[model samples]
Target: MSSSIPPSVKPGGHTPHDHDDAEHLKALGYASEFKRDMSAWANFSLGFTYLSPVVGVYTLFAYALATGGPPMIWSFLLVGLGQFTVALVFSEVVAQFPVAGGVYPWARRLWGRRYAWMTGWVYLVALLVTIASVVYGAGPYIASTLGFEANVNTTIMCALGLLALATVINLLGTKVLAVAAMVGFTAEIVGALAVGVWLLITHREHSLGVLFDSFGTGTGGGYLWVFAAAALIGVYQYYGFEACGDVAEEVPDPGRLIPKAMRRTIYIGGAAATFVCLALVLSVSDIPAVISGEDPDPVSTVLNDAFGATGAKVVLGIVLLSFLSCAMSLQAAASRLAYSYGRDGMIIGSALLRRFSPTRRVPPYALILAAVVPAAIVIGSKISTDAITKIISFAALGIYIGFQMVVVAALRARLKGWVPSGKYTLGRWGLPVNVAALIYGIVAIVNMAWPRTPDAPWYDNWIVALSGLVVIGAGLVYMIVHPLHDRSSGPYADAVPENRTKA
Candidate 1:
């Protein structure tokens, strides 16, 4: 019993939707275009594009500031290790059911379809809200680069322009998205390396003493908890890696390539992200200044200081590439996630939203719809960039919930001795890794949700709370609708659950 269809009278037939998926898979190159040769690199690059700078710059700064000084660097390293364990668990689920829906489908099989629909609806709500966050997150960087005036209109216009560009890029499909990510990957690596070099060469006087000694600058008492929570907020950047798995059907060799691509992405992209984290910690003279409210572009400030405005410009270019790459990557993932939802009949206009372009083999309708939601948020421009950062942080937080659910399901199977087949393996380390991922997730979520104090009205707390409400609302709607439409095979299907791999 997969997640997509509820446990009731199961309907089996050669429906048009079935034919459509098979053909859609063929047209998109998932049927053949995605050979193992390129999948690993492309997926890793995609993951890097999404995780490297977007989430990194926005929330991690809060973590560094709220936590200690350079010790924040170690927080990220800890989070990364925990996330890696979760990623491995997901890889096995993916390898078992290498379809487009990913975890929701797994939920259907293990839990039941009614539950799966509720969960998928929750995921869809998270996805749509995240679109708004991305636009909000990137707006300030573009605005602050040349140092825009006090004119709010000018800032609004500049942010709008970024949204327009990202939306357009998204319309072009994953082939274009992948190419842009590759470019982003190049810029990200080069920029981080360049920044690291400049920091070491010029800011040599800063030293480890400053890095280590700067932690106690904040108010004492529950400060350690606040700091950890804030860092968890920052760690959200590395999310969306699972997007690669969701769009597995659109790739070339899903069974052989999708899991491989996903795992390799964790390995490679994780390394790059670690470098960026380490560079920022090592480079800045004043740790608090970077993530603090002052400098909008902390890394750029370091570059500008190290090599002058020219150097800052160089880093700015990289950050822009990083943001755009992330936007493009996000657009692809969001669209694919929508398509997966449609396949499960969760969204309105499911048939239309899930339509594939006959020529390109891509989900043009879903992608187009995906762009509209985010662009509309950007158009309003009411949500501050910091607010958007919180949203992505919250999105990362939501993903952990999904991770925990899957881990519980997998662990349940393990306890029952009902082992499944898949590509990702945890060796003798499975139980320990699962426990660690759970702990890491719980810590990050608490860190993310913790308010600045008892009276603060921080956007992170608000957006996260609102997003949770949206999930609840979606579940209620899904439940009402399911009773009317269900021909259930279970309560949930892991997400249109059929097993992980078709090959």
Candidate 2:
């Protein structure tokens, strides 16, 4: 696949492989706008950076430890395997479609326009919220690293600054975005591995056996419920792998390479997350205090102990990069989804959103939409200290919902006799993998959205599930108000293809 496109071609330059990619897009009823500059590594880097292990583990370490104790680390393995199944299912679908806007395109090609609209709307909102959540999460670390007091005002400002930086990088073009992602991936992996190894060799405070010891943390439904709540760490770390397919047109031979990138993102990102979590878990100096809520930020507590103040600040810098990279990749994905919707005439501002920058080969209007909404979300955080958290509570669940929509659509297509015709196909294992993906996605969604916070206000407790319902409900109401017509000239414009086996 690498040999298909020559490395000598200049940025935005055309070649034989470019013509091939264009032909593929034309066959799918769309003209190519993105420059095919992202290589397999760049594509994988986008997904890996979005699924940043350092960002995920550091942000949620204290919460997971406090909620479920040491045993919560197991959720990484469980959720990793579960999400990998979803990745496999996605791999198959992306191989067949290889279209922009990952879940939305897959869902549209597999189902119909209304279904695609809802899926894209939900996923686009989720990506925007996730960008806000990531940069917001980065604020405290930024504040602490810069020797400033971490407060609501400071955090909000820091979040806005990071969001602006990420947006600028994204606006630069595909090459810049890929470079930023690759740099982020490199820094995060090196930092995580260095920290993990150092902690294991010199800062080991607990034995491997401690992983099984929950330290008596669960209440109503035994440890299982608490474990489910704690599973947010792994759940949040996994889904960004699909971002690779979000820019399917930006990579040559995406049907083959995108699936490989998705699988690699899952395998490599999962391993990095588990290693980081395991090291952090074993290095916690006061597990009992963490479980009892006395040590609120165990990641900081462990890092400060292991590396001291100066060294910890350096690690924090790396974490800040991971957060920024994650936000940038997410914004890129969101913009692509917006662009895809616009291209298909599925959204209100189709013309503006679909307008591509001739020089940059990017959807400038869509990128602005991605950045503006998330910035507004960050600004809205000033209304309440927990506003960002409430918004973020919806991010993981929203993503899971979007993912399952695609999974369900794929299964429905399969039952309707659609066979995947692509370079990569599951063949005999397709049915079982699709079924497993659906089952796992449903269970994970239920687990993620379950009202687990009993002592909090009713609304706070149900925020995750409620937020998801609100988004989906809003989309449903809009579709009903403006009942969708087959305005799109795209291949599958509100109509499933008669030949299910053809791509």
What lDDT does candidate 2 reach at residue 347?
A: 74
Cα-based lDDT at residue 177, candidate 2: 94
Predicted candidate 1 versus true structure: per-residue lDDT over 445-486, tens digit per residue: 656555554555664436665565666676787578655326
- TM-score, structure 2 vs. true: 0.95
* Clash counts for all predictions: 51, 0
lDDT of 2 by residue, 182-282 (tens): 99999989999999999999999999999999888886569888888888888777878899999999998898899999999988999999999999999
Off by over 4 Å in 1: 1-38, 144-152, 287-297, 383-393, 427-432, 457-466, 481-503
What is residue 265's positional error in candidate 1, in angstroms?
Answer: 3.1
The top-ranked prediction according to lDDT is 2
Clashing pairs in 2: none
Model 1 residue 319 CA deviation in Å: 0.8
